[model samples]
Target chain A: MPKRACYAQDYTGLKILHTLYDSCLKAEIDFLDDHYLLNLIVDEGCIKGAIFLDSHTGEIIQINAKAVVLATGGYGGIYHGYTTNSYGSTGDGIAVVLRAGGAVSDLEFVQFHPTALKRSSILMSESARGEGGYLVNSEGERFIDELKPRDEVARAIFRQEQEGKEVFLDVRHLGEEKLMHLLPQEVALCKLHEHIDPAKALIPIKPVAHYSMGGIEVNSSLEVQGIQGCFAVGECANAKVHGANRLGGNSLLEITSLGRFAGDHAHQYTRSASNKEANSTQRDKDQKAIEAIYAQACTLNFYEKQQALGKLMYEKVGIQRENTQLLQAMEEVRAMQEMKEQMGIADKSPIHNQNLIEYLEFSSALLLAPMIISSALARNESRGAHYKIGFEKQDDKHFAKHHIIQWKREI
Target chain B: MTITILRSHNKQEEAYPLEDKERTLLKALTDIKATQDASLTFSAGCRASVCGTCAVRVNGKEQLACAYKVQDQDVIEPLQYHEVLRDLKVNKSLTKKTLQRSTAWLQTFQEASLTPKDEKFSEKQSDCILCDACYSACPVYAVNPDFLGPFALTRAYRYSSDKREADTKTLVDNVQSNGVWDCILCAECTLACPKGIDPKTDILMLRSLSIEQGYTDPTFVQQSFGFDPNAGF
Candidate 1:
């Protein structure tokens, strides 16, 4: 038995604190001198503006600011249950900009995490396998090579499951003592939730939808390609740093570094535009589109529709996809779009309802899903997470460049 | 196959033969129905560990009853640091209370400029499974029940780290007292966490952030620096 190290003992509490020790939260608490002058506005599209709705009664109030930045994250949540993104993410920033005639790129290429915790849908971070955890079968045989890349690992696991062998993560060698010290949360969950001691037993593992390797295509400056005053960063915006598969820990680097760069660039853009005012007619047009979206999203059956949309994506466009499934998913998305158009409106009272927000998110997912499936179908090569069993080989000859999906007039 | 179990209560070892090698714990107990009452108490659900209700102490270690492979001579007991409702079932109300005290819900601001990075900052920690392994593994909670503990502090950090949350000061103030700062930073919580969430780190981060925001351990500060600027002593 490996003697437990004390450094591994303080892993959970220390790791949790590392996440909270960011400059943003610190600046908000300690650095901000003028709390009164500080106007924190939500849903202002990355600008220092205020769109006020009355507290008790429904009313609209708007305020202008000197600068505007698009800090809206990536479009991963647009793929339903299969994303590493939080539930709040729905590609709202992407959709709003696209509607403003801003060209969108690389809407395809979603990255599916190879091994999510089987039953609970919790992400078993790749760091586990990366640190020497083995994938085993019911016969106690190590089925897949542990050192293989994520996409390969996912494919191998999927293949094994298809062959009727129940696969599990065998971290038993880590032992109860070390597991208790290093991965206490996971071990405890195994004992408590999954009813298995990771130290002594095999953890049931499966692949689930995770990070989107593709998003709104942006250049080096984090500017949305061919769109003025529009930028995206983080997982929502692909800066090409993640070529095919994103390296672990790169997400933090992308968000922090690219977010800062985009903010700076947006600040500069705002300064230059100080002399030249934004087109009033174009602003009015954008406002009308926003109003229309809000109106359509408030239907009584919107929540039901959103749930249906999630099911559709998870069932059809999930992990292993073929042309037949992709086509079927496209048809389902079309039907969902029609339903949204027909349901009209509900709750015109302008209350702070999350249902309406979810409905809007579902609409964005509905639009983005078909693009992902279609692109996945078109790219007849296996590279990264976009694996097509029908066309198995990684034919870099024809599929080297990134797949850019634009919203053409005709589907 | 005959198996023996040593009872901690009477210090008596009981043996009974089992029919199948792959027999479950429940089945084994059922086979030895003549020696003991058939109404023996334990917990099980899903028989796989996803439900988290079937944890018990086996052979002097905490193990999930569903996952643990029973042997010929293994002892069994209930979980510690909790009131046993019956044999193996612990009172879950304490963990639920910790969650309540932590206020793990989304705390939004009246107005705050949050970018994608700000929103994405604490996304990983938000996926807490609420399996109280960290609590059970916590030395502080075992010694002092009032230690706010790892799970609660991690949850507190989750909300406080959110850029959209308007009130970090209020959150910091709430955790300053009640053993939040008193954590010895032994990361047993990290080791016991199933979701790989590190509550120990969250607690430390909370302390550092709190101190930076002017919430200090006055005794420690005075002891270390011997400050008399404020009191004129």
Candidate 2:
């Protein structure tokens, strides 16, 4: 069971953040687009901006800011081919800290949303069920409670999919008028992408990568456990508020409330902090790091390897994981790490070099995959999103306490 | 399947044999980018169409690549009314910048006092993903590059109509000249919206609000409200 039956709700983060970004722009916040973070710049325990690959012009920029916030959403993109995450949610921030020897708790629990479009893995809002809808298997039977815990509902859907049954959300009873009135956005998305009319037809939905319940373990202050001057909130921080499973409706509330809390703390932290690092020195190191990536042998293709890694994670470390598959995932992650070294940059020219940015994303993903597999393996019990078929029971005696990986060694 | 992409650099169409699974145009384009040509570029995010970064010109029609299906011999090109950065990638910042000019931010944010009714009012306008499909499809942008365009005008309506607004006059006054009144309700923007957000309808609504505020346009009157068919000031 999840830590308290968290409220169930659906949200479009980008839409919510549209106003947030509007406010950010109003406050004269500078945005650096197309630049990918290579690594965090930590000097003597406090964070000092980051080193990034300028996607445009390919120069290495050393951003030594007062404070850094790791609100990079979740690592559901780690599932690769099957996920509802945007391409940029590569767990870059979390991966950086973990690689630099930091701690992250509950890293294994990845929440799979009950419904996603079967082909593209685009999200089908949970509001479909909440709005008096029903989930029926191929034979047209409501196999499970629509408003149950996400893990239970997702598992039900997944089990149905395994049994050679296509699962669908039947909202035809709601009629076109109510759907257009109450759930206009989901209706439009369904019609636009899937060509399904929610008012009349069955919307094909399957469990796919949705959210990472586990993140960089942050304390009450929302500061990263071992790392200094880095704050995390939203899906990137493990407050352990959502224990084994997150309640269906409470993700937005957690992020909105906790995100504001983190924002306040980060603001104060930045105000009290002073710039200490010399840019020239950091720039030289950043420049060297960028060159080193290009100087390495160009044998492995980062994009191909990344796609393979995503599919691999989806199969082995996905919704259902066992000891053997987890071990295989660990082995593959190690191999991918080797490939990351000799990653060949396709477009060396820094003018909007997506290749380099994607490579950086893949690097972060490779770093995260091993941690996720190991964390899932260490738990040895089915809890929340980390439900292994072999161990169906939630062993609260040993697994009740949160699992934290104190990453101290650089990978 | 063979896919034809209108390359931005040389302004030429390059054809490639589409390999692998049938996916969204954006996903297919991405696959082509990753394997076929590393330089092939386009902007996309939140493949769910909520982010609205994947707008492009498909068959010379503005469409969200993430939502548009790839067809055989389709002429895929960068979205119109924006500077093309790379293949199928056009700069839509101008559209977003104009939103600032239109004062799209909610000035009166009484979150606690806000009810579900207040939200339902601009529900359609709030659906703008800033994908710029409407902006790209706006023929007004073709004539007046500075036209505040569809999405921005729609956003103006979104913020202007918000009940918490202490005064919508500032928002109203912002979209006066090259903004709301400049919109040509050709319904192209309506057709382009992936979220089914009728920017045309929203623009017309803003025009109505403008008229209420004593703002007038000969084009709007002659086109929308019928300028008495014979009399005009």
Candidate 3:
């Protein structure tokens, strides 16, 4: 029997992650789950190692290492209710850096995908539009060109929905066989979750929170600025590789190419490094405070607060934003931050507890909200994915450089 | 509607009232965690079946929690053959061990001008999300955890069949012991795979490759006795 390899476009790029995971396994690299980096160990203005919480077993582990890479992805999940991010994309690394007084750039330029499954927020790839799929409003009119950049398309969709018009991806004319051959995964997802076949039906879609164009400020070697022996890559690093907006097929290219640069740099840093432990008093205090969460009485659930945050962000800071709306969004984030302490967890068990993890991620989300709003408010001009309706034109003269915010000792 | 979730750690079946109208198993379980109990643990990622982190046993079958719809009454638990880390989350440490045993990575990083043809050749097997559905469903592990299992074997075949690999002998050598041919061809893996990649066929192909290199199944014994030469049709 002759076997020909099939090459359907991997829209998610997750299958490649599996390959990398297998490679890591082959390399004998240890994967530690149920443990999160609580804080970056800082010594003599250099990142020494990290302090982590083994949430499963409820153990606080402090490791002294030579180099650390914060590839924990972007803060898309911080949008909470309507995002296309993984459950783990809570901006943990960014939050850690924020608390540690590390620098980050372009915290406000979040790229919202114009086409995502209406119910689940699962993204339908741009390849759909590339292959002649049209975006239709409730009146079945293609209001904007389907091939427009993400910001324009997302804004159009948002405006359509604001007018109470339902938006859909009309790929019915692509024909069934071609769709099945080219976008088998998209077809399967719609069929399984939406209970509709793209062959005969319109895929209900909306703008969903997708990628963070902002992240930990990194230099050419992908090392975090103002911090020694610490690196950031992928969506978590603001390399200006995507400029203001990310184009298709660039994320995979950027991460693979720059991740190597960071990895090689860190390897060189670690080769001649000696074991030196740093102060973890802050982490210890933070751990204690986090542990106290388990004992708190239930009041406002984290999920409800997260929904409120998501709704507030999508309305005020999302799709289209101006100074007044951004200021209000900042207020809402502040209010949410104030109320987060009252949010309680139901499961307090130390053994593989996801509730604690979610709560911790929620805390990270709380810290991240204001960062994005602050950056957005500071930049009075619009560029890339950061679009304020009033400031639609780019102001490279004044706002060309990065917006740096250090951690306030008091929130 | 209330959904009955079987907690593996406590060995208790608890029914939680549904709140989210999304009706996905992940949402329902998350609702339970948020409202009913905070201690309920499960691994979830992507929430779209793209990440294999949320694979669970729903109604005695393997399915991704984010992909599967919440049923009226369901017995949800952690996947089989893995040590239960907590509630619905299981320890995937063994999956790593088995993957290394199968030499699932490229034997050599020698450059190649791989085309769309090369990509198409290994496409089906490469769709593995490593959600461990096949690994959880494989009956071979019940008898022997040492058997390299489906995901790794399929990966071994994927890399070996790659046009870029200059040395497949290491991969073949890796799968020789407690791997490849040990798969009983149960076809449960095919059913369990959410991506619909057939590992039984991939394993069969690996066996053929092994045969080409003068290696047969360890159980293969020459039939020297009871040879009836004239009994053929």
Top candidate by DockQ: 3
- Model 2: per-residue Cα lDDT over B61-121, one tens digit each: 8878877778877888887878777777676666668877777787666544656677667
Query: What class would a CAPRI assessor give candidate 1's docking?
Result: incorrect
- Per-residue CA lDDT of model 3 for A1-411, tens digit only, reads 232222257444765576677778767898787678788877666788888888667888888788998888999888876788987788999988877767888888999999999988887888788788999998989999887899889989999998999999989999998898778889998987788999999999999889999999888888887678899999988988998888876788787788888899999988876677676775787678777887887688888887788788777878788899988888878888778668877776776667777888888888888889888899888888888877889999998988876654332
Which interface RMSD values do the candidates have, in the order shown?
17.0, 2.1, 1.7
TM-score, cand. 2 vs. native? 0.90
Query: In candidate 2, what are the lDDT values of residues A1-411, reduced to their tens digit?
Result: 243333212335555677787787667677776667666776666777777777666787877878778777788888887888999888887887775556787888998888887767878777677778999988999999998888889998988988999999999999988787766767877887778898989999889888889988898889887767788888888877888688764677787789889888888898778668635555676688767766677776688887898899888888888899999889988988876767877766557766667777777788788989998999888987888977999887888887788855542
Relative to the unseen true structure, what is the C-alpha lDDT of residue B177 in candidate 2, on a scale of 0 to 100?
Answer: 71
* Pick by lDDT: 1 or 2, better one: 2
lDDT of 3 by residue, B1-233 (tens): 66777776668988877754658888887777766777777888888777789999998899999888887767787899998877788888777678877778987877889887888788888888889999999999999978899988999999999988888888888888888768889899999999989999999999988988889887554543656667865
Worst 10 residues of 3 chain A by lDDT: A1-10
Fraction of native contacts, model 2? 0.50
Q: In candidate 2, which residue pairs clash?
A: A7-A249, A7-A250, A8-A248, A8-A249, A9-A249, A57-A350, A58-A350, A101-A407, A102-A407, A244-A384
TM-score for candidate 3:
0.94
> What DockQ number belongs to candidate 1?
0.03
After superposing candidate 1 on the true structure, give the runs of residues whose Cα lies further than 4 Å from its correct spot.
A1-22, A25-67, A78-84, A276-300, A342-349, A407-411, B1-233
